[model samples]
Target: MKFTKPFLVLATMLLISSCNSIPKNQEKVISLKNAYQKDFYIGSALDTNQIKEKDAGVSSLIAKEFNSITAENCMKSMFIHPEKDKFDFKMTDNFVAFGEKHKMFIHGHTLLWHSQLAPWIAQIKDSAAMTNAMTNHISTIVGKYKGRINSWDVVNEALNEDGTLRKTVFLDTYGKEYLTLAFKLAAKADPKTDLYYNDYNLCQPTKRKGAVALVKNLQKNGAKIDGVGEQGHWNLTSPSLDEIEKTILDFSALGLKVSFTELDISVLPNPWDVVGADVNQKSEASEKMNPYPNGLPDAVQIQLAARYEAIFKLFTKHQDKIDRVTLWGVNDGQSWLNDWPIKGRTNYPLLFNREFKPKSAYNSVMSLKETKK
Candidate 1:
């Protein structure tokens, strides 16, 4: 109480120094991975550059904030086995090492898809040769990552909008048996890894029915099936909250784990008359379609954040049945939405922005975990 002015200033300086000396770990804020550690994993897909550890910030952010890693494209058929005889494991090996180094759960994107097929497989007319090629391709790839991969999207985008099998080269050659064959082959290669049937727009009635039938048929045929991946490539307005929840519940009813394999919300206008979530669909870029050329407006950003909050809330409500939810890309700039459907358009579909900083959507989603007990 009777201290001199110099002594009072010295005491204040000491207090300030003590406050600033807090340990880095204590000063660190909770990251997405830390926040959702108990509920479920929070993951983002890694493009080529990320897998190679070329971008220091992205690599560091991934190791710091995520518990899972998915190779963006290296595992695809075209990239893995570009020809009938050759098999390339260069980038794929890099991806596996990257994931293993980070101790992240590795999810193999796809084993079978009509698109991204090697030209030789697509050109094959003989059914027997086609079947042999398919078997060899699946066995080799799955065997390479046998115990390493936690899950595999064994088959992708196989159902048409009307609930019938889309006629691809696989189906044309092997009929409905092709689906079963793919699952069986993957299972044989890695009995431990979870085999999944992944597709987009499972929220639609027809696609949902088709998927249910496919899983049931696989079970009946004694094929080792593990899960279904509903690619959450959704929009803000379309695919109502009810429909999305219905899809998750319906898929889980099969006693199989469900995953949001490729989740992204495109904050851009779509071309007229597009009904289903077909990744192959494309339209000419125009002023009307690419409305937010410069950046997302404040109003639109709020809408995007609210949409993400609602989706995450639904996920939290059904965390038991859902195994994992992975964002399609790390940031808006790396999103595939910018190219597909339209060539050179800006789309803010991810939780992070171009600068590798969290957006409003990230905050909204993370707030769920914070407010939880």
Candidate 2:
């Protein structure tokens, strides 16, 4: 039978309505790793709960968004090698397995750090004893995960603000040669793994110069150093983009890859005198410091989104010179800032909220390449 105009119009209308009724969940979910896969690896530091997959939501979110992983604390000296004669790999083994299961790039946090030393290590006073301890620590840990770990932060926060080496137990016992010694030991353990010198406040000219000289010294001594990690634990306004760009240029000039490790933009009031990520620093919590105890205000949320957008734009601009960008933690609830500088205070710092949902900042970062296209 020949269809009439009214019948044909009704059928067409029903088809259009059916198409519009498609479920919202059917749309593609954007993965952070896929967005910048060509530029650099997208990573996050995993805490103990995440490593064990205790919370299915947390584990699923990590596998979906990130292409790389770092242990937030398990691999550190105090935890891994709690005793000079004993080494624990229970949690560390699980962390590495999680990364390998997802086929993600695994990075070991640090080999030799001034802070987080085992009690026995700190008590040692003799030079020979310290040398033997350092050698045992580096060789044991690095050799354990040789090929499984892609890179290691061989030396972390070794320099002070004045462009001078901080007088840690390692430095006091071994002198300036300790930096060279650590890298050399790491290279001997894992000849193929990349070794890095990581530090905070590296954007400052003096500290940046100190890092440059440190890397140069290691080079002069024929140590294997492949990259530098500028721990980007920045706040809402400081460390101007110009300073960040200059840092990228300066570090890249040394012929080493630059990584923005442990990045998070804290939306909290910081004490005026506090600087760098010194774990020892502490301040009493008060109402003024914990202004947004309930939740972040709409206006402040918008500002946080803008801040993240500006930072990611810079990263994309210099993707060639950069190697990786790893957020400090998976979500705000797990952020170290909550207890750091001030205890029992709320802080919103990561791209995801406490509920594991992507916030405005996540959208701003994910939409970057789209706008460019």
Candidate 3:
């Protein structure tokens, strides 16, 4: 009974199911035409199989609402290189095509990360070869997507939990020069691209200090750093609202564009249960995943809505400093929350409910216009 209208897909699916008029389920999809004004990229962590020309699952939601897209996996090093000495654009090209077809702003996810890199990239321990290879890779990817991507998360998760250099191979081989060179190379390759530094725990003072210092060093070195992407992968109660607002202010104070690159709030049974002894030590991917309870009763769904209201209220309070807000996944079924942090927790922390229906949280975000009322 929410204020939504039946989308074409739902109508079609219903017609096929019963050969009649639209089902009542899609009545809440009110025409969001011009619902958003700012050119911010409201996107998800993964694009799903939409690139494969399928219109089901996460793709449907993104197609319905978003005007921008970020490849959660396509731009990563591992997907680009499952084997060394052979780079494949097979999957990446599909993502690029999807972006253009939808006219969605294409955001290249990452240029460097300690994790998710190919084993071969890790083998380049020497400075000369490492630097050359890095340069080549950056040029190829950025150049390939020149004038294509809306922006790029030029670097991802470069700092540790405590804000220290993560001892990544790029760090060992090239040091701070690696950071500068990567940004510079990306700029030279794609002069129109927006380059950024992406990281997590950025709200923590320790990590915040490290990130600020890194950006400061890069600015001093004449690097053309365009933005800083705060990976908004946060929990329910941690990273206080004050800290989140202050973090944006501090980063924006540096005169760099700021955005939330991969954001998701997990409503776990216990937010602190994934630490130390409670952590899942499983090695196999299957052992690490289990079905989320999906048993969040109706009342709890509205509770989720209030939490979203508070967060969006914060966003409205500081809209000037924020460039974009991206949810990590489109909906519950595809969210990394099911297996992330603890590997098995039924977390309902997004706008869309399990039935692909908008929750009260959805109305809260939709009504997040100016927030003064």
Badly placed stretches (over 4 Å) of model 1 are: 1-29
Better of 1 and 3 by lDDT: 1
Q: How high is each candidate's TM-score? A: 0.92, 0.93, 0.83
Candidate 2's residue-wise lDDT over 228-287, tens digit each? 999999998978999999999998998999999899998999988789898889988789
Task: Provide the overall lDDT of each model, using Cα atoms, as 2-decimal numbers.
Answer: 0.88, 0.92, 0.73
lDDT of each residue in 1-373, candidate 1, tens digit only: 5999999999999999999898654554368788777767778889999988998888899898889888888888898999998999999999889889989889998888888787888887767987799889999999988899988989989999878999999888778988888899999999999989998888998889999999999999989888998888889897899998998899899999988988999898887866556767788878988898898999999999999999989998898988888999999999989987888999999999999999999999888876653
| Candidate 3 or 1, higher TM-score | 1
Regions more than 4 Å wrong, model 3: 1-33, 56-60, 269-292, 370-373
TM-score of 3: 0.83
lDDT of 3 by residue, 1-373 (tens): 4544567678778778785555555334342223444535566655546566576665656777776677777777877865656678887898888778877777888888777787889888789988888887889888987898878888877777667777889999888678889888998999888889988778888889899999998899988888898777665566688888878888999998878877777665433334211123332334224334746667666666776777767876676777777776667766766666556566777777667677777887776652322
Error of 3 at 294 (Å): 3.8
Model 1 residue 159 CA deviation (Å) reads 0.4
- Give the Cα-based TM-score of candidate 1 against the true structure: 0.92
